[model samples]
Target: MNPAREAMINGWKSPRKGDRGRERERDITAPRHDSSSRISKPARQQPPAKSTASNAVGKYLTQDQQSEQFVADEDKFVLKQAKKKADIRVREQRAKPIDYLAFSLRFIDTDRDVFDDHEGDVEVDIPAPETVLESLNHAQLQELHEDLTSYQTLESNARNKEFWSALLVLCADRRQKLKPQGPEGRALASVASDVDNILSPKSLEQLEALEKQIRTKLQSNEPIDTDYWEELLKSLLMYKAKAKLRKVCEAIKAAKVELLRLVDPEKAEELEESDGLPANSHNFAPSPAKPATRPVASSSDAQSSAAPPPGTARFSSTGNEDFSQATKALYDREVARGVGEGEEIFAAEEAVPSATKPLWADKYRPRKPRYFNRVQMGYEWNKYNQTHYDHDNPPPKVVQGYRFNIFYPDLIDKTKAPTFKIIREHGRRRGESFAPAGKEDTCLIRFVAGPPYEDIAFRIVDREWDYSAKKERGFKSSFDKGILQLHFQFKKIYYRK
Candidate 1:
């Protein structure tokens, strides 16, 4: 045995007992001491350093830049620690509601100017705002670049007046939102810059003139001429048919298309162009306060039409029947039976109904669309002020924000039946999150928007033993409580005038 070697290991003040005791003490005391205090107290964390952030599409760091950075080692470490120690007291400045409204108007005016394909022949091509150009490989980028250049050529060509007009309209739209100081509002500076270079003074003046005219036309009363009357009638009929048809189709589609948005089902909506513009969302604030002046209408005018009022729909007289059995029965008994003097009862019934029209299609036309959204600017409004809002409307609910604003696709006419889509909200929650209750359950919001948003707050419902189907989503209010302040894209909404 190597007695000297063993004796040396044992004798040379190993300090093993004290070291083990200290380690044990730390392991026992760690829970009692705030872990953050241990490191940060000694290092003396500095305040988090502020830096400029670009909203441009991609990250902008060369690999070598990290090495080139000339920051003091201790300062950098201190700043990093400080960021964790101190709560960031950032002053959030929200975009004006006008920014959103103007952007929306620009979207509408741009579409009308560029892509309102009455004949469906016009080639209006542009990538969506979210299109990640840098993410593409070189070949894809080259192809995209070529497509964009073609549009640029179209922008300059006087013959392609519509294309040019669209660009000018878009330019003006963005230009309105242009902040004289600070960052440009929702309007991209790059887009505004391009428009400036492309459009000359004469063209700019023409565009301004055209916008004035358009605005004037929008405000003017639409002539209720024969063509307008006939089309209005036609639209009413078609809308009612579609509305009645939608319920049945919706059930069928939901049963099948829960996992898919069908490309081409005759019953499914035709692939329409992007709703006026690319669906790019931005942070929004409430609309600017404006004094509203509404025109007073006679009670007679309001109730004169049998059709459902604008911004509303009247379901078929039959309640929840899968088919038009009552309508079919009436048709067969009254209108279907052609009349003469001997058939007095039937003839009299037919006369009262005015149901003797030759075609069966004419019999059950929509009860004269009373509520059509006539112009892009309509009389009807779905207001959300302190007065009208019912916070817990559509009960069994969870919306615990201080206040909320609603947004919609602008330029919807109340004379036509508008569709509903998903509506979003942004505000602080009572709790930290609404986790389990989101993306799975549907919240039937009673009073929401103008052309309302639906198929939102949506999640797959369970059919088994547990019948309860509600969702909790995103940052839950219960957990993420006061810290979770929500923000949404604002609107340029005014009270109905």
Candidate 2:
């Protein structure tokens, strides 16, 4: 312990003169170990020093330069916003165009009177269900059945229910006709005759109850005829569809009446009074007042008549009155086609009278049919025109073709097709012209159909028609799906060089 204490005290004391001199000499003479000689280590790069001159210049910048910089930033921002807004507007306003050809039946008003002269007219005799059914072959009957089923599924209106009942009656009549002497066939016919009663005057609750009862009978294995009861069940479904449709239509009508009353009380009252008329009446005018008491038919007479009740509304037996979503889509597509390039509306009007009164005018309402037509236009490009005008500066366009579309969805007889005829004015025959210089001869094209639709006509340029069946000639004349179309182009005339 004494030795260690003495050594520590000696180390703390100042170094001897000889030891200090030797150490200083060794530090001075030893090989210098600069930073490069030491072990290398990574170091972060120092940032460049900011120039005080630039900062001083910024502080002294003029007001106009700052304003210009701000304006440039604002312009960039505004342009970006405007582009965003334009893109949104384009998306919102985009819509498909309409094509006149290939139009939908839904847009056509089957009962619309072009002349508005059918007021107070007696209703035409509705086709007998048996007569219509008897004419249909098995395939046609099946097709009709399928169409009705699809229509009923789409909308359950009173008119649809009536058609459905007529179909069932037709089926029952066929079964009875096949085995008239059989008791089962007679029983089936009698049961099927009650289909109308099952459909009409029954609420949805009542129909549902009847359905439950029929199911219960079947489920319990009751001694009831399975086929007859099953048929009743089918009638019940039809009734349900009808009831639902009527309920919806009534609600819509009531709402419309209320709205009309709020807007115009007199029109609402008139509409209400018109609604009270016999549903079969085609006229919108108020009916003649009736006496308080009327003769009641005998039960036997009433039972024998197959006519519908006075309150029953009449509708087209062939197709639906309202447009479905699919039909609307089809209508939109057809309308989008629009007029072809270099074409325009030429003539659109009903046909002029030819001194012959229609036979069905006295029996049914007489109203003009409706039509849409177009005429193709193009430069004649004759020798004189070619010499005077270029492609950029063309001559006046001349009529080159005609397109006619006549709608007749409500023809009284479905068996008959519409017809058209050309009428020359001023007692002039075909190829005869009395027009002044520079004026072209024109003729009326009259379209004829069965009542309640009347004849419609249009004036057209008189020219030689190209009846070639080639598609390029664009000659089409046919009546299909309730539309009578007559499209044809005129033969071009070329001048000799």
Candidate 3:
């Protein structure tokens, strides 16, 4: 036989046909190595299952005991899998406890570890009183005027009464530290509730009567006869004080749909009409148009009287407690010259000499300031001024003085005619300054010099930072703490050697 045939007869497998031939040849050439007397090892058996349930998704069937009739169809398989999963989930869910009363109870007895304890002294984040005062100044009023002009066109674009109502309600609310208790404590809640009740089907007649009565009383400036409701009606009327009663009218009309649903339809209609006064009523009429005709005045027929001429400026030394008359006269002159209402006149007025220094500048002057000598950049220094210790003759204690020593690119001229310029504090260990030259934006630094650096400490008075603009003053010092006992100022120098 061939070597390959002989290898096959020996009951040994070959890797390939060529390898088989080589293996057969080697087997034939070499001694016979094996006899077929070895027994095969048996396969290992799996552990017995605890239950008959198979934890897999399919028709349950045994390896040899499968009956085609017992096999589950696709739908049955899916249904069985879903039930098994659902049962497992239910068992897991039941393992955990559910606190049924937790959600229903208003208060809990659990440990109060979530909230922080109240400290004896707590700081509030309200705006400073000084900032509030600034907001009420002329600067804020000017800003409001600009805003009014910019947003006036969109005023009538939407009929969103809710926005106005919500704002009014918020303004009426005053509590700052805690949430409102309920409808009684919350003004918004009360208003919303009242609105809801008024829109109900049964209250329509009462709403109509209320509106009619309110309208009549408003026209006559008489109070409504209703007990407490009269005050509520009055408040509503006052809310429309700046409007043509149109806002009130519109609110009442909107309430009609709800009122009719709650009350009688006839009553709802009456309230609607009352909310909006009739066309003939004075409460609803649009303002009359101004006349277009211009008045003519004769040139020579109007001979000049003893009255002051136009553009004539007047200065008075008599300190009147009330300058109303003088102010009105000035305003009239401007108006006659075509200056619109309350508009500022930039034109220079006729020059009139003052008899005395202005009271506004000296009315609240400090006694006397202490003086100091220091040239600094961004450091804070504090010392006492001589004014605080002087019981007898008081010399004007001024701020620290520095001589103009070096001429930098941004030096400001202090003599004769001076121009505003940038300043940098050179000697301070900490701090930086960059000033630009401009009429409106330049800073006016006051410099003073009197004593040695050890004599007094310089302080800042009425200095403020504009956090919104991320800008701060360059020089910030204190006079021996908060007391302004010393005067300190900055000065330029021609040379620093």
Model with the higher lDDT, candidate 1 or 2: 2
Ranking by TM-score: 2, 3, 1
Expressed as tens digits, the lDDT of each residue in 47-99 for candidate 2 is 89779988777677668888977876765454333322222212212111000
**Model 3 error, position 16 (Å):** 63
Where's the lowest-lDDT run of ten residues in candidate 2? 96-105
Instruction: Estimate every model's Cα lDDT from 0 to 1.
Output: 0.27, 0.52, 0.29
- Model 3, 325-422: lDDT tens digits are 33223322322333222222222212122223333334332111111122223212222323244435443433232212111111122222211222
TM-score of each: 0.15, 0.35, 0.15
Clash number for candidate 3: 39
The CA lDDT at 235 in model 2 is: 66
Residue 121 accuracy (lDDT) in model 2:
18
Best candidate, TM-score: 2
lDDT (0-100) at residue 433 of candidate 3? 32
Cα RMSDs, all models = 28.6, 24.5, 30.3
What is the model-wide C-alpha lDDT for candidate 2? Answer: 0.52
Instruction: Sort every candidate by lDDT, greatest first.
Output: 2, 3, 1
